[model samples]
Target: MASIVDEDNKKLYIFDEFFRKGMLNNELAQMIKDKGYSKEVIIADSAERKSIDEIKKLGVPRIKPAKKGHGSIMTGIQKVNQYEIIVHPNCTNIQDELDNYSYKKDKVTGEYLNSPIDSYNHGLDALRMSIQSVKRKARILTVKL
Candidate 1:
């Protein structure tokens, strides 16, 4: 859906979306590889195990899995809100999702739900997952060092 290159331009954060729907995992890998991001670290949804496996088969570098949970989602949302996440101008889907995505609400109580409506969330999910993974890895590296 969107990608953010770090200030150094060495790292790339790819937010998955349906820019072209029905694309196979291998095809997607090739497309990313062709774009010269093959060596960059890729943070992908851990829930999509099959697709992740397929991408792994292509030998993409540093394919990190992003764990999804309520806490992680909340944290990711907070991170996005707290920082300036600039998206590429060409990433229309990312812009659209950011604009239109909303939390589900209960009809009777008129209360906002904890989770987001699923329909327009692919890009958002990808972004959240990537943010979570980055945070998680940073913590790990800090602990290790």
Candidate 2:
């Protein structure tokens, strides 16, 4: 996914998202190039070093690993929540992920937990990386959308 930092408004615009299942590194690289995102900075899962290296070797430029640590998810959720996120009309995958990715709940009490549910977060995971990128640059403060 590609996002823009509207620093003036402290808002995040999810401009683009690419979601594909079961793709090889070369295929992913080709898709990035075909989409004209070969030069754009791609923030990916830190756990996928092999895949990321393979993609880099295959020629997509500026692919970076996202920050990962204890509480990173909760922290990311908080950070991203500070900005008003606006999704482009075509980024349906992102929209769906955001819509379904909710906080975990107590099964018996039905109370919202601090952690998010494990399901429905493929796009949101990427979104968190983008949020981390923005925070690393200190581009803005707070989220609401």
Candidate 3:
């Protein structure tokens, strides 16, 4: 899973369900810890989907329930306000912007390379916010409502 938080203090956090067990969990936790972040400051937002053991293994601070028993568009947006940085997928519209960046294509067939099938809109939004945070320039495609 992932970690989400609320407020500038970064005291509140939301973590995903897969914080423990497999190598993935360890890696996820290690990534944050490696950056010198405490598990207490990180919360698990999707704990219901995963086992409690997995949640504890991550050692994050708080666990919040997912909205409407599942992740919804509104909840996803709400998550943005909770944390300083949000790393998610970019929506379909974002593809147009990313399209400008050349990706590897089939050299032999001369076919255009395909973008990731997964949604990167959220990640793009997060990245955009990060750029703005650093006083970098970026195109604003969507409203922050």
Candidate 4:
């Protein structure tokens, strides 16, 4: 789980759980709603096209696709730093991902590469998507007015 404070400093917490055994869209949507995040936005992986469609069928609101690429991930990380981030203690996967996440290194020059290591990144990816989704929404709102 992750929490973010908006421009008004209002805090909102969003949760996502991945079941290795796989969960039905209805089941997952109910679980999320039970957690009191039914009104909050959900950022899902675009790779899960079928799952996204199924979740939509379940009537869950504000489901958005996460922007892919290192730049989007980096932007999310920056946004996290900009806001106060509160992680639930039970969110060990997120903590472990943040702890072990690193940038690739050049073999000959020993310089850090732009790409990030793919391992231990599931939680990180979810968090990144959430942040990016908020940022995108904010941008759209700004453009509208």
Highest TM-score: give the candidate number.
2
lDDT (C-alpha, whole model) for all candidates:
0.61, 0.74, 0.36, 0.59
Model 4 collision count: 0
Q: Cα lDDT for residue 100, model 4? A: 91
lDDT string for model 3 (1-145, tens) is 2333334453322222221224454565455455445333232333234632353467633322233334343344454434454323433334443444343568799776543233434333332232222212221111111
RMSD of 3: 12.6
63 Cα displacement, candidate 3 (Å): 4.7
Q: Model 4 TM-score?
A: 0.69
Best of the candidates, lDDT:
2
- Assess the local accuracy of residue 120 in candidate 4 as a C-alpha lDDT between 0 and 100: 78
Give the root-mean-square deviation of each candidate in angstroms: 6.6, 4.7, 12.6, 6.3
> Model 2 scores what on Cα lDDT?
0.74
| Model 2 misplaced regions, further than 4 Å | 136-145
Candidate 4 residue pairs in backbone clash: none
lDDT of 1 by residue, 42-115 (tens): 77777776776677689665566776676787777776565455655666777787789898899999999887
